[model samples]
Target: MMSFKRSRVIGAVSVAVVGVALSLLGSACKSDRAVFSAPEETFIAAEVDAGECAAQCSLDGRSVIRSCDGEVIETCAAHLACGGGACQAPCAAAAADRSSNGCEFFFQIPRYDPAKFDQSCAATFVVNTSLEPVEIALAYEGRKLDLSGALFRTNPGDATLIPHTGPIAPGESAILFLSDRDPEVAPPSPYDLYRGRIACPSGVVPALVGELPGGTRIASAMHLTTNVPVGLSMIYPFGGARSFLPSATLLLPVATWAKQNMIINGWEANATGPASQIYASEDDTEITILPKVDIQGSIGVKAARKNMPVTYRLDRGQLLQLVQREELSGSIVESTKPITTFGGHGCAFVPSSDLGPCDTLHQQIPSFDQWGSEYVGVGYRPRFGNEHEPMAYRIVAARDGTQLDYDPEIPPGAPTTLSRGEVAHFVRGTGDPIVIRTQDAEHPIYVGAYMSSCTEGFNKVSFEGAGDPEFVNVIPSGQYLNSYSFYSDPTYKDSSLVIVRAKTRGEFKDVWLECAGQNLTDFRPIGTRGEYEFTRVDLAKSGQAGQKFGDRVCRNGLQRLKSDGPFTATVWGWDYAASYAYPGGMALRKLVNTPLDPIR
Candidate 1:
């Protein structure tokens, strides 16, 4: 089995304690933040060479994204030259790879060491983004890789670097090429999950691009930093199982992560299918899983099961094997220290049937403090072949006597009040988004959205099912964002963006989307419920060589989205078999993005 080797560092800086702009990290306690701590022999990267650096600089508080209009700011560290919105080092931009100090302390937590996992994959990169002139630093396998003297390219052709590279200039990015290796053991093992920290400024949207295991598919996602004290939701790509493309994205920041939680397995929805798994944030955290117990209530319902609880401990940076079950599959997970959790099946059919709409399932569940009382769960489109798996939203209440109200309302028999350990699932009649709110803020709940398979039919009649079922913990209204930069599955040719925002007066009109530097105008309101409204828009996928579609904005990687009001957006992906177009295939994700605003 590929497992993380434990190493703890006693040092000046901890990878967990990323020290840049520290005040913005929300908490003063180092362990409570998202990053791993650095070793004592660390690189004070800020101390860059003064040789030919941009003259003049400033430290405009860490609260906002500064636009560089070719002017030096008010003040800058003596070693840095500030201009063009970022403080840069003359030495940093002068070279691509250079090592200032040997950061040999190996205690950085949540690490990615191929040797420990018994893999020989050589991970490399060519980085490029809309944000240029960005310096890059990486701590890998107990050493800090230096790119201080490496090369940076604007239009990528052969952007390559290792361990580190000089700051990527604007209009420039680098490329990474990692060789896929075989597992050391022949016996089957759980999937290998990688964890580490990559840092740049919040204005810089980074991405780790490469191939996954033996699959030819591209494993990539936007690498946005999750340290914003106010907009923490920006970091929760819920990383693992980038199912839409079958790779890893980003995961929980230590701030919004929980030390304990529960998972109601697939058995909760379908006896024949719907499985689940648990992913830990850090290694060595002990997790206890209690079996599903039936609610003991008589009238209304409770939220959880109180049955057999099993305890297991995991090494740092490991994912528990996914277990598929046919009976009640709910399990409560309690951990000794803070950690992150993902609950979903390896692959299952919503309204399970072998016929259609099937894909792998994965979602990072939020800790209790991150739960919200108000939410709008908007389901995805129907499966291929006209399959009628209705969009289902399951609400798990955390308190007893919690009253739930729905906009566009629930069916006559569905109960609105739920006790602790109870779950209330309701189907949406309109494809538009539906709103649910608790009577008071005292009770927060978990809202998960499930899409039906392309195969299953509801009323004894069925349509052609195309893809598979998947689930994701919806972001809370409190974590809603107004601006972001995101990337779609580069492997999937077809894509759609589902946009959700609170319907105040004329706010939707201000939503803007830009691809390949062209303004998009195809957004249309699909539906609305109570205080929220939904909009759907198709994305232009890159077409054939030199065969251009007039004004087609179909480019992948590093796209931008911004709105005047707080909003939620998800990007869906499917196949390109021209025979099975857009809605024909299946893949969905709540887009993780970097914010354009300062901390709230």
Candidate 2:
């Protein structure tokens, strides 16, 4: 069995003490916060490369896609300068062969109706994971939604860099607000909107290359690229007078584009809104959709029933969004060539509708080749000082006659056998973590974790509300990584993380976590026995009792976590009747070949 190896730095060693970003120290000198310390070498040191390099479109055969003018250009493979508008070159590589760093990416920001959810802050974060500095920009063609004057802000600096724009130092991030907000409109001072954008000054710059649409909000298909590889993440937080429901997901680069995928999402029993599956094409592509439920087509599309396959064609930079009242889980999507796919609910009342409120769900779907046979489901620990609530989950089978076994005992309502394209729904109620495994590596499944709904009686709540419905993919144990650079949205007052790692002989392999200069130590074991264990820690809290809805803050921006052995973490934030959840990160290694045993 594959297991996490301990870091070579040191074993269970405690080191320097950093100042806490929030909360007062206890009288006994004990931190109310969980202590998760590790070897001194676990914390990543940021390095900056002062050298300069000329920019070239290094996505291989991918064209520049578009420039100021709408003229087509030749392919940019060998000696071609990086200025022409062309489509991506053909990529026959498998999805598992790709990594976090890549030159090109396609982003179709999920459609959020202002009528249903707040659209105050929508942004896509681009992080330079590589050691060297890289130039990043946005690209699109035949736009449906205009992005004339969208703005981006990097690290603050003197007048050396472009106005309001500076070099994204290694391990730093650039925030691109996804709105046509006027440049002269003077964004909020200190930028206290979503995710806390800092570095005030002339460095903010318009990042798109098109005509400015006067104050028009954006929800369209666009492409982004860097001179070198970087990481991309999307966060849509409804941060206004209404609710604070946020949807977030880490995007896979174009190098990981795959032709086959399955939609695993929450089941909404009512007609509140439609569950959505969106496809963004980087080239002229043909796509076939086999939805598990009936789709109420719109505009130029026709309605289709369950098990019926619908076909559509999309040009480079074009997008096709399919929506239905019923849940789209178990849907099978395949294309002639590689394309980017996303699945989630526009807004859903998870488990049941009596939970009072709903939240939007969004996640970039990985290709079938990236699916795994094993996973650890650790439910989020109780916040608001209430009893732990069950976390909802779904396991979508990729092959027929798939068998499942749990480490301890299977949760109630779990199915041991599932046919192809079948989805089994269950919930984890206990605080202990559960390890789920398949019969063999040949049978793989996609696992999705969901936060239980917020109600008056079921969960303790203040005016800001308790945990509501949020959805994020569960990272497979085989895809665990040693380090990750992730961002926690500072808007939510109650923010926490669920950390899971592999262990052996009733001992932990030792991993460390640091956010806002404070290192976390002391992770307690959960469950009776297994090769894995988990612990939940609070990154930011509300009032004294940790129940306040609007009193949370953290160190300005992105957080980095490193360890000697591999582990997985999930971030959760909630307040004011809204909440959001997403995995810290995962390695998309090709584990299975879908073409050989195609998903039916």
Candidate 3:
């Protein structure tokens, strides 16, 4: 019998006291490099003989004295406020206000076995969107053994509990690297949030390759918690600096987890296979997988025929990985408890028959509860100097008899109606954005965007002019927000953004990109779609591709977008047959029957 070691850490902090007790979430590390330190103290405020009020300096050095009746007795400045009978710093006072979505997130870095060689490093970038300074930390978990050997092992006594413990200033961003490479091989300088190199962990073992047997115990999932709301983007760069093979996904926080989800993936690949991975948020999570295509079996996991359901169980911080020879798009996953899922190919050819070079594809998927009936379908910008080049897209139905209507006219090969779990594929040329909607909210669907293949032929290699395959989810009109805080990677040679905004009274509203130092007024209306408009911009600091990795230029660091009406955006970049794209951000508002979890 195989035995696995597990740890049960308390989910939340609790304290019993006559007066309020404030305790920081982390303690000082005794290592030679001290990240943060503070004496864990219990303040017995009730025993203090001070008068009816208390006095103290705020964390930001603001002075304040407040009465016990929750009355603000004194405030040092317009931005300062009295808290716990003392002036509070702007960050401490704004700590109560979280991001629009959530603060706690958990995810695993899926294996990205490149077609040529194996690249083992992945990065998770975080942006602080709140006024409060964010403290990022990982949930405590005991080391464990899997069917392979020890997974993500650290040095003795180094438990790997903290993730660059430090304050992330408001509107600033940080990127942490997770890799199996040597620890001394660190990312270039100027990354504010990087603590050190972390060991890479995952549900799929590299040695086992395509087999994920039952009861595999590996502590490879990352458990991130923040004092305030933040946004996360995960990147797995497959090719080295000389070549481009990177895949990324904008991570959704745990508060957005749902009991039901649908899979959207790229075409099958011979290298790493097409797959979907799910992470369990609570113990004893029972999952049902209904494959749209026949699924291959592992050692202890049975194979399931198309439409046949297979069941599996996972606990918190544990994950289930499913890899199949056939493309797994349109599959349905249901669970007894909420779970987070990601779907993509290890390395795939966007137009499977078009090109020679292929790249990895990955995107975190939203659940059925968050699906919407209306979407803005925009194609990628012209690639490789071909102004007439086309991009591919797919719309997956969530309910039976879902009818879809397109503005102006539908694309080349799109279907007007679809059955539950069925997918409709289409291709649109550059400058041909369209609006897609169903009859009503009763018929919701998921939409995905894809970049065309490199050069479209094996014999003709236009490495410098063309970009390989890349995948990004399209945000629904219902999930659009007026403001977004995003990041654009400067590592690529070219970075471009597509902004889709709703129009009012046949007129497009004003939009602004704060970091670009420009106000956008060149919005072009989507084909005969009177209610919406879109435009694409190259994200250059001074409208030039001079930004490099670790550069604090407006094009590389944290970015801000604002508009009068609801809108959504996508940030993408390409470098010689390599590309990456992801949604700027979206509101995870509930649109179905799944009960929403409270943000902790």
Backbone clash pairs for candidate 3 read 384-465
| Model 2 lDDT, residue 46, Cα | 14
**Ten consecutive residues with minimal summed lDDT in candidate 1?**
96-105
- Name the lDDT value of residue 364 in candidate 1: 48
lDDT of 2 by residue, 1-600 (tens): 112211111112111111111121111012232232323322211121233111212122123311112122344443222211122221211121254445677765455333333223456766555444557667656533333334343221111222234556555565665533344454434333442222222333334322221111212466776665566777764331133456788887777777887766545544245445445554567777787788676665667788888877776666666555666777778887887667676667666644566667788778788888988887665654543566677888888889998867877788889988887778775265677889876788988887766763222332236767777888887677555556555455666777887662235556544442333455655445656767666655662122111232233135456554567878777766677777766767667754524325
Candidate 3 Cα misplacement greater than 4 A, ranges: 1-101, 112-117, 139-165, 182-219, 238-243, 269-272, 457-465, 504-507, 541-554, 593-600
- Give the local distance difference test score of model 1: 0.37
For candidate 1, give the lDDT of residue 359.
41
lDDT of 2: 0.55
Worst 10 residues of 3 by lDDT: 9-18
Residue 7 of model 1, lDDT score:
16
For model 3, how does the per-residue alpha-carbon lDDT over 448-551 read when each residue is reduced to its tens digit?
88886666722233445456788898988777755566666655656668888875334555665554434566787876747888877665422244222222
